[model samples]
Target: MRFADIVIPDTSATRGALEVATAYCSPALLNHSVRAYLWAAAYAGMNGIAFDAELLYVSSMLHDIGLVKEFDSHTVPFEEAGGHLAWVFAAGAGWPVERRVRASEVIVRHMWDKVDLAEDPEGHLLELSTALDISGRRPEDFPAGLRAEVLERYPRLGLGEEFIACFRDQAERKPDSLAATFVRGGVADRIRANALDG
Candidate 1:
């Protein structure tokens, strides 16, 4: 249950992000976030795409932090709110402005079903990884047994239902929020019918 003690990349930024994210996010979300990072990184490696692992680690781990009370917002989309929080963390951690900006972009854009790959390959990785996590979309893309290992290491623990509720809450609180848009557009239903239980 102690994730911070787990071994990860030795980079200071990723080391800090893992610690901060593990401490800040709920258990279910922590599991999901780490898996997202793993999936995204794995995809990058498989496809010969170059990426900053530190940025992906920070972006994916903190991507859902906006759903937490400390960063939740009525006016901003949860994605953007999380991006802003990630930006703050990155800045305080002394990330260069460009790097932090890319982190924010990667975090904020995951909500879109499609990402402009040329604009942000990192964002596209997030889209693919989150889509897989949230809905089991394109599960075949990940190598066999990878998902099993991730699940074993970090169980879902009702992450599906929890995220659905968070979206529902966001919908209720702000009809104009992205969650509300998804709800009104029937996307929420599709997301819930996804393979996961959380």
Candidate 2:
């Protein structure tokens, strides 16, 4: 789907924020972001998380606005980028600080499997959203240690052994790759934020 296809309820602030973000990044990623929003929404609904679908859509739509300002991993860590983006968009659009803060948090922690939700709500939500997006797919590119860690923490996630094997073998064979790990990490934190939030 085109980035333009991503719509948050009734042309809200998120729509304007996403328009600004699309001007900077590839539309392809925005498409993926839409998928992420769907995943998060479904997961939240199924698991009884008190999430607002429209708000989640809006947060996910503008989650990566930091890329618009050319913020890097080193200078603007992913955890902080979300909050920063919300603030920037809010400032640009004359939005309130509270709204900006919520959006910014979503962007900052969109990649958060390794984070603890008690400490970081935004990261947890992103993690949950990511996990739901790739629910049945195996991380065939994750390191052995990382795979073990995930399984240990979420044994009840019920991922099949075959899927785990596929991810482990592929990841081990293809060393020096960061795609699987980073992608998983992004969702991990979001999941925690969304699932573990009170």
Candidate 3:
């Protein structure tokens, strides 16, 4: 069960996210998302983290769904509504209640100075995913508004500074444990072999 094979694309959240992900952000955002979910689930499984794979997978896909709809426009929201704009998009998509709620929770909590770590564990996962998405490269390439949030929420994972470091180290040294590689290769091959490209 490769990561890409399970990514449901027809949902409202996903449709909006794909547009936002491809246009507002880099392709790597989409790539890293698949990687993050795979890595997080694998790690959880190996260490007994008791995570819901489906929840993590879907939550990860939609965690940044807010980003797609709220970039650079002042009236775009992310303001007094407490990011209600993003949640509205997710909710309006007709996603299952649990998935919508979880996705909304992660999205709303992603902004630092806004995140309540103790109350939102999925938010922490979202934070960790955000940080690991760009840890090895120039910090400038990261979303300017998101850096503080990353720093604030990442440490809460209790993986320490070494958390992302460890994942990076594993990816560098042990590619099998590296989820992104498998997902990309798998997705590409699936598209090709299954004639999914249209």
Candidate 4:
């Protein structure tokens, strides 16, 4: 499935993942998820990184699910909670156990500072993509044309405010989680300063 110049994986698993994201995420978050996939896939294509499109799509779609009230965890960080949810979703999609575990790992690893592309291509792509989307880090790494097309297609839709609120709630509740660390580390300022928002 192609949206604009981006090639989305057209498969039952990918479709199912999109459906799950649409059902659970708010419009702003859902758009952010799709944009995350496009950014990652476009970067991979440009850089000659071999990746599993289906896995990346699925992981991207479900990566921030734990931020939604329906799936939020009290004790664990949102990324870990979302990773568990992705594991179950992959299993229901009839993925093999290894693939299911890989999906979970990819989602969880997106929150890390960096993921080694050689070890886990999907994880690395997702990490870079989400960082770019959320904080506007290294926007120049992607082509100017691709960035323009993606933002025009998906739009930010107040993601900066919505995401900051979600993180604030997470920080207040799970003061020890990574979300708290992000809050303490000035994630809101970073979000507001994102070049993409302009």
Candidate 5:
């Protein structure tokens, strides 16, 4: 069955951000990032939640950017680092401060165990989308064959293995960072229990 097609927002700024994010992030991270957007946007559509496609796209696309060594920090959490990096990228792309900050909130809070939906619904959708992509939470929610189509366009390419390693690296190097905290706080178990294996 053909699921509703997912539309990508492709303004000039969005295209530029994609290029920079692609240059910095690994293939798996990049694919996962884009898939996160697709999942979030699709979920929003299914749920009838109106959203800012541009902001969501940018935030989701750059969510894992802190993992890139060029922006890596020894002390700061990757989510926050990536948030700051995305903020800068957004600002450079001519986003107003308020909107850029909003986008950064989505990136910064994506790793949170639970995001406050009342405060930022976009971020909330993003958080849920990543959870769906990474761990397959509420598998019944997806439209039939939607996941297969997304994976075909942006294949996981062993993203699960790659991500777990990245999480381990964070746990080892920055024990106090969010990645480290989540990794130590049963993320591995979460991933294992929610394996994406078909």
Candidate 6:
């Protein structure tokens, strides 16, 4: 599946991930997932970063599954729960144990403040891409043409408002979770103020 110049990995694993994500996540969230992958892939292409597109694609699709009602976990952060789900999904796809672990790790690391590209290229790309999609960080890092094309292809669909609401719910229920920390740090304001929202 190609979007603009980005070639999304077309594999059983990628297809299954997309199906599961589309079945569970809201349209806004689903689009966010796809955009996350595109952003990461584009950045990697420009920066000469080597990555496993199938792994990245699968991880990107399932990275936010925990936010949805079907997969939300009461005992852990959404990212952690999502990671577990990704692990199962990867196993179902016949991924090796190491590859499965890598998928889980990439999903879990997307919420980190930073991921060292040298340590985990895919994790670093995902972290940067999710940050860009969610909080509109480093809009200048991507070319204007690429940004416009991606946005046009997958509109935000009010992700700013929906994501803030989801985080607020997570914060209220899991006060010790990263979602709580994000709410405490005024992520709502950042989402709303994102230049990309306009």
TM-scores for every candidate against the unseen true structure: 0.89, 0.53, 0.44, 0.96, 0.92, 0.97
lDDT of 6 by residue, 31-147 (tens): 999999999999998888999999999999999999999999999999999999999999999999999999999999999999999999999999999999999999988988888
lDDT of 6: 0.94
Off by over 4 Å in 2: 1-8, 67-74, 114-123, 132-198
Q: Which 10-residue window of candidate 1 scores lowest in summed lDDT?
A: 1-10
Instruction: Write the residue-wise lDDT of candidate 5 on 1-198 in tens digits.
Output: 233466689897779778987998899889889888888888878878788888888998888888888998777888888889888988899989998898789998898778876787789888998997776687677865887787788888777777888888988998877778778777776766654546
Write candidate 1's Cα lDDT for 50-145 as tens digits: 777778888888898888888898788889899998888899889889888999999989988799877888899998999888867887777656
Alpha-carbon lDDT, every model: 0.81, 0.49, 0.44, 0.93, 0.82, 0.94
Arranged by lDDT, best first: 6, 4, 5, 1, 2, 3
Model 5, which residues run further than 4 Å from truth? 1-4, 193-195
What's the lDDT of the predicted structure labeled candidate 1?
Answer: 0.81
Candidate that would win on lDDT: 6
Sort the predicted structures by TM-score, highest score first. Answer: 6, 4, 5, 1, 2, 3
Which candidate leads in TM-score?
6
TM-score, prediction 1: 0.89
Residue 8's lDDT in candidate 4: 84
TM-score of 6: 0.97
Q: Is candidate 3 or candidate 6 better by lDDT?
A: 6
* TM-score between candidate 3 and the true structure: 0.44
The digit string of per-residue lDDT tens for model 2 on 95-183 reads: 57776666666655665545455654444556665554344332332333433433343332322232244334433434333324643
| lDDT (Cα, 0-100) at 191 in candidate 3 | 25
Error of 2 at 43 (Å): 1.4
Model 2, residue 62: what's the lDDT?
66
Q: Which pairs of residues clash in candidate 3, taking residues 3 or more apart in a chain or in different chains?
A: none
Q: Candidate 4 vs candidate 6: which has greater TM-score?
A: 6
Superposed by TM-score, candidate 6 places the C-alpha of residue 184 at a distance from the truth, in angstroms, of 0.4
What is the overall TM-score of model 4 with all chains considered together? Answer: 0.96
